[model samples]
Target: MANDTGKTTIDLGNLKAGGFIKERGKDLFTVRLRVPGGRMTVPRLKKIADVAEKFGGEFVHLSVRQSIELININFKDFDAVVAELGEGEQKVASCGARVRVPTACGGCEYNPNGLVDTQRSALEVDEKLFGTPTGHHKFKVGFAGCPFDCPKSATNDVGFQGAIWPELNKDECISCGLCAKSCAEGAITLGADGKPEFHPDACIYCGDCVKVCPTEAWKAAKKGYTVRIGGKWGRHPLVGTLFATFLPEDRVVDFITEVLAWYKEKADGAGRIRIGDIIIKEGTESLLDRLRAGFPDFVVAETIPPQAIATQVGK
Candidate 1:
């Protein structure tokens, strides 16, 4: 983990090769502060700004998950930076293959496809999944308020979507084509009598038609967060794929925490940072087996799943 002869030294702090470390050199360690749900009150933001100005570079960089990143500091000052960041509040997970930060569409309760608030749960997940690994590359996780990737969750190493199952009310079938139009993926269709019908497989759960339905007929079958894993958007450019269908809010954090630990073991110091390569060569089941070893019920063939092709989220 450390090299004494060369400038590269083992970073006790979760300094990732591709993250703040790459931006600054090996001698300098970078720290990422987790801002749960990518949201912080004005006071927290101010505290972060203060930390960056005093300890790190003059400007603080924002991460894809809405976390805070301060770069270009020597390893000597890294601990002090962390202590300052966690001065009053507990510093959440921000680096090392753990859940990066949380994301929500900022879509409030008024969103039609939603009957729940995903932002709160997204933050909860962030708290539960906070393990930093010292292998391969840095891992990131994200969440969405709806299927719409407001912050491009699909492109992360692990991602979440506020998933809702669409339920079609056969009795209140008034198909004015409004709902169909509202859906970017054409999940809804007009029947013979202009009634609305839905294709479950085709729906991405992006909260689009909820507000458009004047009759309040479009119903969510089940509200939860969908999960995706092993994606990155840099030189490697591998978009994360949808991994799970129904992940309830209470379980999202725990499930993701499990995923990170597994990924760390698989990395094993020689694994690739981009996860698509592993999935393509070793297969998802093989990957899951390494991650979920103890649970007899944890069957990748029956438990874990393959990722679906992502499309038509924000649109």
Candidate 2:
């Protein structure tokens, strides 16, 4: 039903269901479109442009999470634009205490520095978990192909970064120091024995040493995701600390689902409280204990606390 002004009165339910945010003008709303992994074909982009020209102000805004927004849309044209989007295989994005659209780096597809296929990982997570309600506050997930962290995964609710622990083959060591020079974090150094030694605790798993190795000395011993949890970006930003490492890609969706379910169970009555705030209220150790009991199969790795990460970045 339309109001006397001919604009649809959007309630909270409709806002969450339709992915439309009421604009300053009561007669207009902004529609959000999901672009998973920030990957889109040219034809889809052109179709969005056409729709925006017809309904919006002939322009679309790109959001920080890689979604597209068509602003200045009148309520009268909402159905038409939604129909056009469906024809193009584009779906409206969601908000309001739910799993938001997943963001990701370019991944190994084109980025020479990437360690894993982040786009594929992101799409898999989006398919399995996007729009699942948290019932307390918004939850965000992001993927970075490597420690370069183009998407700033560390600041999201849950973040995943590609990693590969390199193992040195001493027999093939030429002592050229290429790996040491390539390592931006100074995790690799030449030992008194003239062979290269690696400090696993200091490594960011960027795979720079593997790429620069002339001989087959540095090899990937393990490759997987470095997981971070209880992070957020808002009026008060908190960088998530490392929770696990070498987490296999196949188990990522399950891990995320279980984590969200746990959060819902714990924060059911806590209105508008973020997961990070919960961690602060009850120490991280307590949460980690519960998480460990829930998923014993997940391999835990050494973690870098938020303070250490900040100190390293400052240098």
TM-score of each: 0.71, 0.88
Clashing pairs in 2: none
lDDT of 2 by residue, 1-315 (tens): 367998665344434544788899977888988888999889898988888988897678898889899999987676677787774488788878888889999999889989998899888988889888888989999999999899988888889999998999999989999999989998999999888989987898889999899997999988888888878876667788877787777878987887787688778787997777776666666556666775554536344334222333554
| Residue-level lDDT tens digits of model 1 in 32-82 | 666666667888788778777887876777866666777776666665666
Candidate 1 colliding pairs: 2-10, 112-210, 165-221
Lowest lDDT sum, 10 consecutive residues, model 1, at 295-304
Give the runs in model 1 whose Cα sits over 4 Å from its true position.
Answer: 1-31, 52-58, 71-86, 90-99, 102-116, 134-136, 174-176, 261-274, 287-315
Task: Please give the lDDT score for candidate 1.
Answer: 0.62
Winning model by TM-score? 2
In order, the Cα lDDT scores of the candidates are 0.62, 0.82
